[model samples]
Target: MLDFTKSSAPAFQNLTPAQFAEGRQQPGAVLLDVRRPDEFAAGHLPGAFNLDVTASDFGPRVAALDKTRPTYVYCRSGARSASAAGQLATAGFAQVANLLGGVLDWPGALTTK
Candidate 1:
């Protein structure tokens, strides 16, 4: 259950690639990639789930996630993920993290599937 009547909204953190990697290893953490299917198929972080930000079901898909759990989001250039993070916060998500500069600034190894 989420308390949407709070006076203050939860602020999503802008984490660097290293910070984002470390945080994603935490228990109950969800790695969400907000890029298109084709972009995701090319390459993406290991274990990340695709939820295209441009899709019609984006809001509904995000709403289905556990709002209390920590969610890590990323996009091609960080723009879409940033927007997604804001949406999540507005939807009463308690914890949200955005990957600064998105995958473009990621210094970690990526996987293609």
Candidate 2:
């Protein structure tokens, strides 16, 4: 098992969809979808960007992200995002958060485009 408490960033902090909605309104905030490209194409949050953790380049992909900003990550349930969040933390991302229930509990306010 992973020792999230030892990390520089918090682990498993739950963020509601509304919180994610608000984050999108803030400067330097990014919503990161850790789902696969196909799942993302099927449906995702309006402004969320897809970066699959299963890919071999996941680390480099996240490394390309702005480490100075907060990133909101989510997956199908909560598993993948947790992993991705940990990676981000290890990669020196300052602030990171994860959606509690993924898109399964997004409350229908989410839209895909």
Q: Which candidate is the best by TM-score?
A: 1
TM-score (all chains, Cα) for each model:
0.89, 0.83
Query: Over the stretch 1-113, how does candidate 2's per-residue lDDT look in tens digits?
Result: 97876755545356787886676567888889999998898888878899999999999888888998888899888788988888888888888888878888787545557
> Least accurate stretch of 10 residues (summed lDDT) in model 1?
2-11
When summed lDDT is taken over every stretch of 10 residues in candidate 2, the lowest stretch is: 5-14
lDDT of each: 0.93, 0.82
RMSD of each: 5.1, 3.5
**Candidate 2 global TM-score:** 0.83
- Could you tell me the lDDT of residue 60 within candidate 2? 88
